[model samples]
Target chain A: MALVRVISSDGAAFLVSQRLAKRSGKLKTEIETFRKSSDNSEAQPEIRIVTIRAEILRLVLQWLQQHQNDPVLPANQNEQDGRGDAEMGQSQWDRDFLAPMDLGIVMELILAANHLEVKGLLDITCKLVESKITGRTVDEIRTAFKLKSDFKGNEEEQTRLENRWCVEN
Target chain B: MDLNGTSKEVEEEVSQHYVSPPVTPEIAPTPPPPHLSGETCWDNLPPEVQEMVVEKLGDKPKLLRYRLVSSSWKKTVDMILERQFLSVWTEWEPFEQYPYKMNMHDYYDYICGYDELEDDDRNPTTGVILARAIIAGVPRLRPIWSHFAEHDRKANLIPSFDHHLPAVHNPKLGSPIPSNCLRIRFNDKIWPEIKRFERSRRAKTLADFVVKYDHCFSYLRALLLTDIEISPSNLATILGKLTNLRALTLEDTLLHVEPETQEENAVLPLHSNLSHLRIISTNSSASQLILKAYHEQVISLETNCWVPLFSKPYGNLKRLKLITNLKPDAQFRQGEENPFPALKYLSIIIHEGHVFEWDELSRTIDACPRTLINLYLDIEPRWETEEDKIRQLAMSQVTIPNVKTLGIFLPTIPQHAECLRRLILPKFPSVQQINLISGSWGCRSAIHGKSENETEVYDREEVIRRLNAAKIVAKNVERMVLELQFYATVCPKLEYIVII
Candidate 1:
């Protein structure tokens, strides 16, 4: 296997096939750039993802490896489906893979997936955040997403009055 | 430390791609739980990411709720809503306190228990709905049932509706709803008719164009644009700038020029919230422009004139009111296919000018979706000569299985009760309510300059006859409406006949 070494922000390193790494659009560019400059064609490529922590980086790679043979969705396909990309290819196994993460970790994954241009991970992670807010009240959303109301003074009251019109039906 | 899980053995086939799973041993027990530092984590997601999260929320009402999370989410939600409503034109109740409840009996009781909010009596969505401006001139709060029906016997009893209109209570039947609305009344110089309506002292209350009304953009739910010329780009920019509108009603509007179809929308499909589209007195050319821009989002459509736009069944339409002719042509696709798969309410308003016109309506309704619940028609002004047309209407093989309310024009011509009864009761096998209305739009057409309602320039007897006509429809239609329901033998489930 043509292998590449991936390093997370917290100094953790992962080795995966270069093909799997290339699924992340970011990693593909880095590996191709490494090949262009290298003296030895046999040399393995190394990529440092400075913003993603080890825990989050591992999930993205695992997701990429699991769906390696699946055709990457063209980025423009979101509007045509009338639904989020998370709905198009989400498998039971993908659901199981996401079931245990805390919403906080999911946020980190969204950031990392977006940073790496991993459309599938970005879609599913953003979808997970959306599920939390879909039918929840403001206070419930605050607790679920770990958000706190930061409005002070009459701003809070004005927002509350505005919230009165927030009918779901 | 061995985070990389890959065998040192290189693939013999260098051209093939392979993915080996990562075996990062140190990351097995996931790092500390997010709750330890999660409180501010959501607050910390970059604005773009936060926008992505709220965009996922999707539900417009829930998007409004998401604003309460923090000042950050509020700004993001506002920006998202503005972009969302940019193409939005809704005809829904903006100040509706509750969602449409299925079990409306209990829902009515629940709402009646609480006092209504002190209405500002200013915004167009509520206290001074334009209907009040024309009817009676005295500002009586438009009754609740007019907008949403199926509740108390009291509301049902006082059943006379637009003597000009003639139907059971529909928000659209009386006055246009202002619950979620922005009414753009043009200056007299621009629109001569509006100048007459606004000449009254209360005109000041109905003032303020959207350009100057700063508070409208963020919460704008419905837009009522009158007397404006809309081109594709001007409208897209005006509507797209800042509106969460789900309903749009355009009256006496004109189109400047037909631009070539623009490229596919470059804006991200960030919001698909638009639902209600009503184009009144607009030219077919201009009407087609609005339809082309909004076909994807419209669920309820009310067009005063029928345009030949349905080449294929535009999907997801639930409520359609063709307030004029059902296109005197053979456009409705026949055969086994149901063209409207989701249709729930259909109202075709054309009287029997000729005998053949009645036959066309029967053929038009044959392709109705099995989901139809309310079917209303306005047919009148014939003597015993049109009995065969009514007979042809009853004999047609059309049988709607789910209609709860059937509305038709009850022609008050002497001794024509048999035709009205045969024309209605036999077609809808599952009707529970029959709304028999008696009136002609010709007598007091709101759009016609010679309308009855006084417009500083009240002409001749039209105003006197219209004022008395509204009272007569409410009082006299009750007896004839009650007599027509003797179809105890026909529609067994029929409960009440309301005269509108």
Candidate 2:
């Protein structure tokens, strides 16, 4: 397998297998285009630097490395997977993986995963965020995320009035 | 001298009066615009990019926050959020009991009311108020209308929320309505127009209202109708308008009309894009109407009624799940003659009232046995007797020639293990997978008497022996799923065994 050097936005470089690296669709496309455009056969190409910031890219790479050998989940599998036995209980690995991250970092990672088309990472991050939000009060969410109370006086009052119907008894 | 002084003073006073301007109160200096801080406003992002972000957010709670970001973002969020929530809610919520009562008025009020409002306004105080109003208002409206509105009309409104609402409330106008005011303003703008056409007048009954609101039912892909009573004409009329529907569920609802009337009113044509159909019916005739429709339109059928077994078999079905009290008969037809050539999964529940005659079931299996992948048989123990022994023997003899997965549910402990022993050791030769689910009463003795270790050992050995024999008979057996209630006494030692 040919080795590909991936440089994150912070200028840190990591060598990964081309096959594994191709899991990130953006990188695959970039390399493919680069290969197609190059004319010199002996050209020692500079390492490809993906522009995603270093921290986000690191998390993405870590996830890709861990799930390198797992089955390639279909694009629509997130919707179709439902609540299978494998997903019913929290896996300890997933718990530890997500434990250290804050919501903002998790959100950024979700965006990164989506941009990279990393389905497993996107799913886990989305589910992690979903788990946090599911039963929480709006106030709790605001406090957790440090959201400002942007509603002007009665505007906030009216929203609660409207949301009242769907709130769980 | 005094006169001259007076004249000078007069001149000075006149000059002062001429130069004086109207006195105005000093205004407090306006505060400088509050610093625009934190993340960039979601609206400032390009529209296409915002859409991409919303798409990435999919239908999750992230979208909820996106809506609260700003008036423009709220519009985008509301557009997507309403449709997604309604679609999933319409399909799943009706059949299953919710932890809290879901009143349509309250739901509607909440969606309509909160959707426009700013996030801050929806506080505990207003939440209580709105909740009370929804709880009080929804119960008064008949249940049928609520169910009908949920499925047929809500989906069509998705596009309106997504496309129309944003256009009308262009955030670029600068003076954006706060989230709290948006919903009220939007409703003020639209609902009165809808109501003015005497739309509310036509909505005296649930069916009548849904029909009248047909203009709004176009975008729906999935619909759930539970405990709603509809006449054949009304049902057809309502169904006909929902052309974009993909999944349809009719649960515990009564369809009271003649078969001929139903045939005339059958709105779902053979080419309708419906893929999945689940009908849990208590009425036999109604079940038949639904099955007839299934035969005509659906690719997958799940029924909790036994009428299909007696009715002419359907041809287009790709999956069939039956839960009923009907007995199997020897002459029961199978396949396209009983047509299920495309069938992949078959699950049947067998109880005292619904036992399939042994020979009938065998013959049914023998016919249309091709393309069948998964089969589940559930037996109620109360009816298991000596008479059932002959039936069990017939079942053992029947060839499942191509079955890949098999599940058997037993209601209680067997009085005699002879039939099971005979059946397990060398029956159903082509089986690759097996699941045995035993009832609570059946495994009680084994659970109560033995130490946990002894229990585990005995169960494991028994399962291994049975499976080993099965492996010998059915050379392709590779996986088995065993679910026992209270009995840790028998475990299966298959290579891929899952104990539940």
Candidate 3:
């Protein structure tokens, strides 16, 4: 099979099959653009994703390879379903793929998947982040996200009080 | 090798295995990524990603916490909640006013331990609670009870109201629930205020709610109001204030003035931008008469009263739901002009014993033959023999050319089945979705003297067989929503069966 070169932000280059490279919409577009500009020759296309680091890029590529044969969902899949990604069911394998990653890596992977236009990966990663935030208190979420609470005395108390109705049992 | 490292180490192993195809060997478990510092957290993610994260949270309580996460997070979540009202009971309160004063006797009978049932043993579903509350002369409870009853019918059992009700009140309700059942922390003061109705600061009126959540009204797309206390002019004023409101639901609410009475009527140019209006009032059709200015803009309308539809032409109406009895008005002027030129979704729900209008319904359907996309007939015919004659005559005059969905919520007895095959299916040859819902009175077997459990199974099989035998010849049925008790196995291209 024909090969393609994928270069990550941190200067890591991996030789991937053309089929695998086509899984990433960004990579696929890049390859298509290259082929169009280069007269559709047999020469391999090199794709450099500047925003995604080597490790994150590698994880994204792994996900793409695993789901290489899966049917492509429409761009307006969420619109068609009339629901957001949180409600979409992911496969057991996809769940397992994301289960081990720490929150930091998961967030990074979400960014990478987003940059690569991998809807499935982006959806699952977002769902994971949502799972972490759901049922958690504001303080707990703040801790998880390492967010510095910006509200002071009265403002903070008011925000808390306003939101207290939602969590009240 | 360090026990804890960045994800880079983990990827190195994965890449090596991918590059060089390895023999079937158990892979070494990589060490977990080191604890992430405050370098990259949720806030640092792109705003679109943040929105996606929030969308995935789904539950209002979690979204509420996220709204206070940070300024940026608050902005994103606020936008979402504005467009979609996230408050569980904000638009749909269970009672107009609390059932405290009116039925102290029933309330006492249930909550004051008249039956001597332990609070833990009294695990009534929201349906039962709402039913009891409605029976106790609470007018506001009817709408809420209807909502829960529909849910109960869909679930085929009383769905636990555990999520909406205050869980800590084990004194009168079923099972002692954990305080965090609704995911909100109950303030020590508010709990007593909600139950006791004593000296405390709590939302007692819709006006109070409007003041508290004033920010939501500006961008609110939909609002369902059933509180009778709010007058028509007050509602009109409130509707006028909601700048971006698109859908409005008025249930059993009254409006005093008529729109035709231009001189005295204050609500003349109502929410003209409203695309959807739902009126579930059985007693008062005044609210429907008040919103005549919106006829040109309303794309969807659901009402029990037929006056709103028959009174004048609604040229832009794309959907119409007749929940109440649609009696043919004697004054409805017959004309060659077609109103509802863009009408697509038509749902006529005739309850038991209500007379079904054959000629008027057929005329309505004939008007939108090419435009109608979905036809739902939720009718419990007064008499099967009479319905057959009416169906044949009515259906002969109409044909929905572009209809893709056909939902029939009627008894699937042989006679009705024959009528469906003869009258309904052929008229909608383009239908790809068929939702065979059982009538509100449960399956046909209930009337045919079958065991309760066996009824559902028999009905499901009967429906499939009858539908298949009807032989409409429409290929690739995609969706079939049946009663909650039954699962569909007949459709060829069935993606999923909605159990409701």
Best DockQ among the predictions, by candidate number = 3
State the lDDT of candidate 1 residue by residue for A1-169, as single tens digits: 6789888766577887786787788998899899999999999998887777676787888888677656678887887657668888688988999999888778888888888888888888888878776777878888886666776655555555443332321
Candidate 3 per-residue lDDT, tens place, A1-169, comes to 5677777655567777766676677877888898899865898887877676667777887887676555666678787768664346478888888888878888888888888888878888888887887788878888887778775544444545434323332
Q: Write the per-residue lDDT of candidate 2 for residues A65-139, one digit (tens) a residue.
A: 555545566665546665522253235776787899877677667666777767667667767765665555656
lDDT of 2 at B91: 38
Q: Second chain TM-score per prediction?
A: 0.49, 0.51, 0.54
Runs in model 1 with CA error above 4 Å? A33-44, A76-78, A81-84, A163-169, B1-40, B87-224, B227-500
Query: What is the C-alpha DockQ of each candidate?
Result: 0.15, 0.06, 0.24
| Model 3 lDDT tens row, B315-368 | 888777776555432323445555667777777666667655545444444554
Candidate 1 chain B weakest lDDT stretch, 10 residues: B106-115
| Each prediction's whole-model lDDT (CA) | 0.56, 0.45, 0.51
- The TM-score measured for candidate 3 stands at 0.61
lDDT of 2 by residue, B1-500 (tens): 12122355434432322111112212232332221122223333445434544545443334444444434555554455445434432232111222244333332322223223334533433321111112223332111111112223441223222221212222232111111111110122222333222232222243443454444344345555654445555566656766666666666665555444335445433426766666766366556665666565556666677644434545666666665565443324523355555676776655435444444445545553467766665643333456555345635355555565565543223322333334431334555445554322244234334322221223444654554453422432332212221122221222222211
- Residue B134, candidate 1: how far off, in angstroms? 18
The sequence of per-residue lDDT tens digits that candidate 1 reaches over residues B1-500 is 11122333322332354333345634443354443233337765777888877877764555666666777777787666545543333322111112232222211111110112124532333322112111111112232212111121122101221221212222211111112334443322322332232322112222222223323443556666665554544555556633566677777776554335462242222236667887878888667766766665578887765656655455788777666555533554643455567878777666346333445556655555679898776654344465465455443767778988877654453234555566546778898876554335343342233533321323223322443355434445444444454555688887665544
Q: What are the fnat scores of the candidates, in the order listed?
A: 0.32, 0.02, 0.25
